[model samples]
Target: MYEFCPHCGLKYEVEPGYFYGAMFVSYAISGGVALVLGFILFYLAGDPGGWVYVAVIAPAMVLIAPVNFRFSRVLWLHYVAGIKYQPEL
Candidate 1:
């Protein structure tokens, strides 16, 4: 079930125990987004007073949690599935 890198479109084989990198990528994206939002709120409020941003965006994040989960898997598979795409017949 080796795959290709979607970002770079590089075809490569997935080594044993290699899929874990996808989880890291997903977490990095999600957590980075949250942190950036938090920083912006704090900066604009002159303190941590703008919790409304967190309250609103946090739940939105939760709602999209499933999407994020699936996205990670799909991203990994895109790289590791080794499935090639061809134009329609």
Candidate 2:
């Protein structure tokens, strides 16, 4: 969660509440993770009980929280905000 990028001196937040969109991105990422994990567990685990999904998906989301947060922000910045990489800058 840098206020600015050290390598390029680029400010991370373009405006107030800029990152609010990132929350939705994070939600989408999380939902996708849960669905994928649930599907995998459903098939590989031989269609275990409902509690099994709750048990596995809960911890898996927690474990991937940090990665999901950063990834969502990066996705928001690169896709929604139209921030382009300036390799020369």
Candidate 3:
């Protein structure tokens, strides 16, 4: 990623470990996905085996990781870092 925002020239790396907080956001998103997916699988699949959950959920999480990663960072940037979009920039 760029060290600073190309639009407004805002420094994205505010500190040595600024993005660490994004991990929590990612965790929350992933947890929610797993929980909801679990419910769907449990009901739709008629209470499948534990291995079935692992087989499906693991790959789903892996497939969504990249999107979840960027989403989490964007969320953290807006909510936690207070970064806002500026069309004028």
How good is model 2 by TM-score?
0.92
Ranked by TM-score, the better of candidates 1 and 2 is: 2
Steric clash count of candidate 3: 0
Best by TM-score: 3
Give the residue spans of candidate 1 off by over 4 A: 1-21, 50-57
Evaluated against the true structure, the overall lDDT of model 2 is 0.93
lDDT string, candidate 1, 8-54, tens digits: 66555456666677788678768877888777777876655456876
Q: TM-scores, in order shown?
A: 0.52, 0.92, 0.93
Clashes of 2: 0
**Cα lDDT for residue 43, candidate 1:** 84
Estimate the TM-score for candidate 1: 0.52
Model 3 per-residue lDDT tens digits across residues 1-89: 78987767889878889899999999999999999899999999998999999998999999999999999988988998898887886
In candidate 2, what residue range of length 10 has the lowest lDDT sum?
80-89
Error of 2 at 30 (Å): 0.9
